[model samples]
Target chain A: MPKPLLALGCEGSANKLGLGVVSHDPTTNKTTILSNVRHTFNSPPGTGFLPKDTAKHHRTFFTRIAHEALSTAGISPSDLSCICYTRGPGMGAPLSSVAIAARTLSLLWDKPLVGVNHCVGHIEMGRVITGADNPVVLYVSGGNTQVIAYAEQRYRIFGETLDIAVGNCIDRFARTLGIPNDPFPGYNVEQLAKKGGSVLLDLPYAVKGMDCSFSGILAAADLLAAQMREQDRILSAEGGKLKEGEVRITPEDLCFTLQETVYAMLVEITERAMAHVGSKQVLVVGGVGCNERLQEMMGSMAKDRGGSVYSTDERFCIDNGIMIALAGLLAYETGFRTPLEDSTCTQRFRTDEVHIKWRDD
Target chain B: MTASTGSQDFPCVLTLDVPFPTARLASIALQSLQVDKELSALVRRTFSISSSIEGARGDSDKILKVEYKATTNRMLRVAFNSFMESLNLVVEVMEELDADVLSTPIAA
Candidate 1:
């Protein structure tokens, strides 16, 4: 049998512009990622964040990166059967930039352009890397967190956060703790939680059916932290503060509590989704997926189910182009292409809106 | 082809002329129809007016001319109800209303 076609995927959602090239070999029934390129945007301090500015930045950076990715894979654009890009459910400005770039490339190279859902791309990539064919997908990122399962020409959401995502909760909590907003601050907080000797402060846990409310938890965490700090300041002024080192909840301990509480909520919801779907496997994907504690909890859940918990290494698991490309190729083969007139931008595209096709073999 | 029905269901474009204060009036009318049993599920599609309005000047008789694509009578009725509801809800700026302000629906 002939080998499957090779496709390139482009992603520029949030701050990262990622590119990946992959081949689907039908003879072996496997997909191989050739190479990937990633670039990030750092808004200058005090410069207001604008979606359109990011889009403008993408137009300048994309062509060179595409070439770099192709060359890194030791392949040419001419060898690509199709080019895929994230279509919607992202900042309209950035989505349009990548869309326009993809269309231009497709037109020039005479290749088909497949628009892939960013969320589905993340989930499918997680599935591909972990080799989890039908695991429950808990997708969490800067913008989204939805418990999803693939069925009926769509990846249906079993449950999701009704408000802000779990990661944003952790990130915003870190900021309230005066901790820097970094990719791994949340992870740092996780480690601190490990070291923290439990105070077990009372905090709200909001879970509704399979769906959850992270915003309440986040608000509570922030308020608690703020209130504790205020009390500490008052004690200091009264000369009644801890004798040099005596403290109830240190910064590290606060970080620990935040991570523990957020992760517990996520774990609870994930387990609910798993039990509801009756699926043995669980696939965790997103920036928060990198958290070791989250992984451990999911691993135990998988063990209980007599199944395996699958996750990718930091690179593939994090938002990137490789997942987009891998998922994009499947969509392309399924004849999922958009017309020029119908092309538009969107910010809240749900995962179940698109039909996904990719086999884990 | 054999003649089968008393009246044929012809697909035609009907231009609905809505007399309202502003486009916001039309938008409000549409929003109200979403939960109204008579018109809730009848709205097949909706589009915003793009051209700037300068022709109509009467406060009591502002016109919102909508071109609707409908086939069956039921759908046309829904469109009419939706348009009327939208017309009723339109205001100078959305903040003036007591309704919960929502983030605009993400266009796809």
Candidate 2:
């Protein structure tokens, strides 16, 4: 039997170091993911963030996950054709950890090392899973949220949040509610939104053109909670027993309203971008891409445009290693291998900065 | 430090004096150095060229200031140095300015 081309992708931009393994299916001209693993970090001590410490997390997670993925795929180092890792647009600590480990593995295992852009990997992984060609991308995550389109050898940013990402805004809102971020609080908020019936709380909606202003929305949400708390105090002082849903914006209601507003903002901007690019298909990627609300909104927007919206499952939606590996494989094919001496790690690297000379064959 | 010669027209006062070629080289040199390794690590990524220029300071070659800021630390300083050295440009230690705060702007 012919040996399979084993490709591994590594991702550790923020809290998770994801590992993904794939076997290139020659007949289909597509790569199939075999196994994926994500290892989260232990929030660093002192400053609440440490580059070196996070890098350490990437290293540890990458090593363990890489081994497990290989084993799970029933392959060994010799079967591996290339090793790919997240290159940038991330925290330096985490990026370097993966880069250093990847380079080491490539050298030791004698495999070509491919450096993949973190953002592009997110986009491509979405494209791969959805099988969407030349689709407009709505990439929303903790670190970034932008409507993008590939053009003229680059992924141009069509529209974006002026300050902070959608996920970041949600996280901040969760914090105001004293919601724990552990075990994925965003998911919890989504679940809560499902349970609580709508209370119809009014809040500011600030969407300017194709861009978004999350600051105003964040402030509005925060103030709404504060006002609700004061109302509860007044109600209690007036010798009145406040019902569970009275004088309080149920977490579900808040989640429902917030998701509606955010997803609407995203859908409008993405539709504008699609029209700008004259594209019909839309591919939603990133952590927030996993949101059912966002997907549904995008689906409707696409329908209005006489197009379609495609999103990856949870595995590809969140940052994982397989996307990196796939991206790396393409980049390597196009001669994007960084020289060992030239290999370095960084926390920030914009998507536009990279010239897209590589593609999936 | 307060501006030595405050002029409303200028709003900010600065000085630049170098040989013609050296001034030009200085600006180019600075542009290349701004993305140096040490700074890239601090900022956390590689940076693209923002801007570069050359000016006159007598007959000798002088590169003027080049300004750039990397989004993340990617050892751009090292890459830049290697790029300049490959072109036979030897960078000298010049005054490194801070980026509107305690953080010193990394210039390779």
Candidate 3:
């Protein structure tokens, strides 16, 4: 029996810094996550995380989390096959910080390095955790929103956001309402949206072919929020509440409307991709994949097509090192290793750029 | 015949060795500062973090070294001023919002 392959993955594509260790058994073709650790850089409300700050967060937490992951996995550097780090499609500074850390670990441990694409990491992890084979994937997050499918050894992007990502839309809206950044702004928005009544406020739904745009909707929503705030201020100044019959929009309403409109657009594009690919299985991956509303909507769509929807909870869905480990392990099994000199990270690594040597289908 | 040295021949150079509590902070500062492109062709800048010897020894000690070169003292001072503004913002944000500073572990 061949010894199980172990890989250490470091991820800091955005505000989250994740470190995880995973092992794979070639005989059974099974992958096991030994340890997964993450640290998020949450900024104050109304302020997005700048690349510099996010990169700093990754650098500060990289070593501590890496140590914790290795210790928790009970594996020494000698036991690892490779060190995998997110190479791209993220903030340049954060990606570089993590990449440099990975390079340092490679030099320290005398191990080879594997640079993993952030999107592919999410998809591979989702497939491994949920056992979804060749499913149409909806990869949504703060930085990216895309509907992807596999074909000819490539994760073909069928639909994607033309402007701001879906998660970014939700986050900005949360800031407009001055929501707490603890946990996450999106989670807070999700909570508030639950309290909202079924009154769908009018917002732009921009879907062009298989692509969608969120900036226009974001602007429209911001305007609505501003108007709502002004109305509330005026009403409070008059020492009176909203009139009995006057139409009033609350923050909860704005959140609910935003989720509905944006998620509907996402669901539409995902469904289109599924239809185009003629695949019934839908896998939702990324930070926004943890949203129950999205899963529920995707589930309904897949169910209508006589199929099932697969999604992991926050642990696997939100950016984590385990995903990188899993994907890199697969690539490693296929004799893929990034040489030290070529281990440079990029900010715009596309999913298709990776040669899917591990998968035949 | 006489040899002459011009001001351009002796470029103004500035080096900053900023220390952080941890090598991670220093690396962050280095990476953040490295993003700013050279504003002037006459001015050149380079940044690097000191290797984490203390990290290898299980201690948090790091330093970021930045070097600037400009053809004239005025150009050097002007570029240095802009770099300082960005560097200050990065450090301030790191001090305020870094997970290590907040003592919050991000593992679930």
Candidate 3, superposed: residue stretches over 4 Å from native: A239-245, B1-10, B14-108
A98 Cα displacement, candidate 2 (Å): 1.8
If the candidates were sorted by their TM-score against the true structure, best first, what order would they fall in? 3, 2, 1
lDDT of 3 by residue, A195-263 (tens): 995688999989999999999999999999988987888787857687677678888888889998999
**Model 2, range B1-108, lDDT digits (tens) per residue?**
111342343222322222223343344434433332553332222222222233333444443422223332234344433333322322221111111211333356
TM-score of chain B of each: 0.35, 0.23, 0.73
The digit string of per-residue lDDT tens for model 1 on A90-160 reads 78667766765565456445577777788988987887778887888888766678888877668899888
Query: How does model 2 fare in lDDT?
Result: 0.67
lDDT of 1 by residue, B48-100 (tens): 44323455444442444455545565676666654543333232223221122
The docking quality of candidate 2, as DockQ, is 0.02
Better of 1 and 3 by DockQ: 3
TM-score of chain A of 3: 0.97
Judged by DockQ cut-offs, is candidate 2 incorrect, acceptable, medium or high? incorrect
Candidates by DockQ, descending order: 3, 2, 1
The positional error of residue A226 in candidate 2, measured at the CA in angstroms, is 2.1
Candidates in descending lDDT order? 3, 1, 2
